[model samples]
Target: MISINNLTFEIGARALYDEANWHIKPGDKAGLIGANGAGKSTLLKLIVGDYAPTSGSISMAKDLKIGYLNQDLLSYHSDKSILHVAMEAFERQNQLHTEIEKLLLKLETDYSDDILNKLSDKQMEFEALDGYSIEFRAHEILAGLGFSEEEQKRPLATFSGGWRMRVMLARILLQTPDILLLDEPTNHLDLPSIKWLETYLQAFEGAIVIVSHDRYFLDRIINKTVESRKGKLTIYAGNYTFYLEEKSLREEIQSNQFKNQQAKIKQEERLIERFRSKASKAKMVQSRIKALDRMEKVDEVDDDNPEVNFSFKFSKPSGRHVVTMENISKSYPNLEILKNTDALIEKGDKIALIGANGKGKSTLLRIVADADNDYEGTSTKGHNVSQTFFAQHQLEALHLENSILQELVAFAPKHTETELRSILGCFLFTGDDVFKKIKVLSGGEKSRVALAKALTADANFLVLDEPTNHLDMASVNILIQALQQYEGTFIVVSHDRYFLENVANKIWYIEDKKIKEYPGTYQEYEAWSAKRVVKAEEPAVKKVKEEPKKVKAAPTEDNKRLLQKKNKELAALEEKIAQQEILVKDLEVELAKEEIYSDAVKLQDHTRRYNSEKASFDKLQADWENLAEEIMELEG
Candidate 1:
């Protein structure tokens, strides 16, 4: 557990955090969110003591351990296997094991009692630390992060920067720190890896503070939200979605109060101005002035979400079919990506291709875009269809010397400078920002520039791969809006579910070396997949549950057949119970007759018959209740 109090941090003249306060309790899963450069990542660094706070203090439990995963860890290099790197989290255990090995060697040479005793003590400590199973634990965490067994055994220096980031993440997880501070933890993870991490974090006993733009990941993992805005930290009781709703409502109230306060001050000032010369109202004016001065000013809500006012248009509309693939098959050495897969893309179809890594999602996108032709397939475009491929490689395609505006101008020759700048504005590069050179921009800025260029192209069919990567929440929202308004067909491959759900009307996935389509939103696809998995495993689970019932004897047996029989008997007994009640009522009516009351014999006979019927009805009701209970239990 850690606590941040009155944290005021500054870089030269700029205050990154001003009087910010946030408390991370044990078992808390918190999402730290904000716009770009709002200091979410900086706050994480402050927590881990990478930078000293300008003022205030951070308090933590003395024995509390913190594991931080950040982009800077990408520079870490090592020749040791990834497994060894991950298992390094057990530092004490590793040292103990080394000592034990040395003692064993010394005993082999000297056969001394001191060496044997030292080895025994070291072995006891190692066993207590569970050093023997550390490798297994490290392997499990690495695999969950999408590392294969062989890859885990390979040297860490052989992996790319993104894969190295995953290794750092794995090491942090293996450490089992008391609190985890993760900055964009899902950035390097694919969809399946993201899901696996979600499950792992859900079960993690330690607290977590995640700074990420992945809304879906935040919603699935975090129970609380801490929004960094205007150099202050504000806490919400629930996840990202809840924070949005609660913030909207709070802003509405604040805006109203601010308006009302302004009106009151205006009225007071007018009275003061008109009554300055009048002696009678002087005291009232002064009182009103003091009240206005004492009142706390309410701040107006900032407009965080900006609409993408620009529209995407192409010169020619595509035919009914935008793209078609027949008998498509792609493979690599020792890996089969796609096998005779057939898929078609119709005009106006916004398909989201999703799945785990190594499933050929990007490969399939390349094939559709005609960027890769080595595969055996027939890929074609419809008449009048113009294609544009937007990928991470697009970042590489941008000229570093060119400004954002110049880049757009080169891509879209027909659009005027004013028109191109308008599109750039929607991507958050406004005014002078459009003139900034591509070389000066950050990774996220470059991505936005690439996306702006992609939109500038007059293409009727768009193939976007990981379009939301390196984008902030606001940038992702802008892209979603742009895609929503675009009339052309597009297929986007992204791991962000919120982005996919908002933009796509169809879902595509690869399974069993074939392409599959689900004609619904990402939310619908998730629900269907969940039920499908349950149904797939239900047969085996149901068989295990039914085996005992099938072999039981008649008394204990409550199989389907016996359950049905009980249900039938309960139904029949209810009818008899109903008739018995009517019979008892009829007997009561006869006993109440005037003639029967006057004659002793008739009255006695009628009373006795009524009593007999009532007793019979009571017994019948009791039997029905007992049978119903038995049936209920048997069914339960």
Candidate 2:
């Protein structure tokens, strides 16, 4: 738990947070949200004591344990494997294990009482810590963070930067600190990995404060939203969706108050003007003027709504077939990235390509965009397709010396400088910002410039690879809305589930050496994918008819043996049949239920149960007939 009292942090002339009082209680799953420069990450750093506040103090519990994972991880170059790096979370336990092993060797060499006593004490201490489960727990966290079993054994130095970040995440997740601070935690995670993280954090018994631009991830993982804006913080009691709705309502109230204040100020001004012309009413006018001077206006939150109205106008629609891919296969040495992948982009079709990290979704996108021609693929563009692609490494690979305006002009049409500057302003760059060199731009600022360039490509087909990276939720939503309304073919590879759900009319799932399409939204694709995974994991066995086991009648004088045995077995069978009947009835009722019909599993279960019950009924009837025949034979 941490508390901030009267905190004010200023960067240059601008105040990031001013007089902000906040407390994060134990087990609080809070989300830090704001615009790019609104200082969400800076506030997180303050709590973690990486950066001290300009004024006021941050207080924490005595001996508080905190773990913070920033996007910028100091490179960890060592001989340690990824598993060993993650296992460092239990370094003490690991050391204890080593000591225990040493003690075992000593016990064989020397039978002295002192050595035996020391070994016994060490063993007891190690057992108290539950040291044996440390390796298993570390592996679980690593797997959840998307590290394969094989990759865990590989040297950490072999991993790329993104995978290194995941290794860091895995370590943090395994640490289980009292206070967990995460900055854009889900940025490098795939859908499966993100889902795993949600499950991990949901059950995590610690305080969590996360800063993420992924709306769907925030909505699923966070219970509270702590929004930072213009030197203030406002806490919303709910998920991101609830925050959006509640914030809108709060803004409407503030706007109404602003309007009423303006009206009152205008009325006071008119009254003062009217009386100022008369000598008799001069004292009353001066008194009212003094009152007006002393009155402080109600603070209305600054609305950035106008800055968000970005409109992208393309030159014109292109031919029917915007792009095409056939038998695409890409490989990097031993890594067979993508194999026999094929896709088509018809004009005005919005498609989303999705998969786990290292699954070659981006590779497929690059092949389609012709950015990587060293692949076996026939990627064809239709007449007037004029393709433009945004890659994941675009920001880092840009000409840093070029100013923001220069970058735009470099990509935009030769004579469209004026129009390009206007477009840049819509994305929150103007005046001096446009003149600022790219070398000085932050990760987010560079992303905005890249987006502006992508928008002005004058192309009907868009191949975007993680374009939403470094963008805030508002900007991502605005882009999604624009794409939804755009009259062009779009193919994007992204981990942001919410964005995909909104904009994707078709989904391409790259999995298990093949590319598959789902004719629906991301939610539908998720359901089908989950079911497919479940099916894959399920035991492959044909369930055959199981003969019922029989128990002999107990011989007791207090009861009729034959009758009691028959009754007991009958009752047991009846209960089972009743349960099955209940299930059948529920299925029938649900068949009439529209909601249940939409779920594939429920429908499948219903049909399977219906057939199973019919077979059970036949078997039960035959058993009854056989039992009756035996009874009559015994009676005769």
Question: Judged by lDDT, which candidate is best?
Answer: 1
Predict model 2's lDDT versus the native.
0.79
Candidate 1 lDDT at 298 equals: 87
Runs of candidate 2 with Cα error greater than 4 angstroms are: 305-316, 414-418, 533-636
Instruction: Evaluate model 1: give its lDDT.
Output: 0.87
lDDT by residue (1-636, candidate 1, tens digit) is: 688999999998999999898888876779999988899999998988889999989989899999999999998889999999888889999999889888877887888788888888899989998889998999899999999988988999999988989989999998889889999999989988999998677656578899999998988778789999989999998889999999999999999998998898798789889988789988987887888889898877777888778777799899999888999999999999999989999988999999987799999999999999999979998899998899997798889999888888888899999899889889898879988999999899999999888888889999999999999999999999999999999999998989999999999999999999999999999999999995783323234346555443454454777888987887788788779878987876675444544344665576677778889888977887787777656755
- lDDT (Cα, 0-100) at 186 in candidate 2: 84
- Return the TM-score for candidate 1, rounded to 2 decimals: 0.82
Quick one: best TM-score, which candidate?
2
The TM-score, computed over Cα atoms with residue i paired to residue i, of candidate 2 is 0.83
Residue-level lDDT tens digits of model 2 in 378-471? 8898877877788757777778889888888887755377787877876778787899999888787788788878877777788899988888
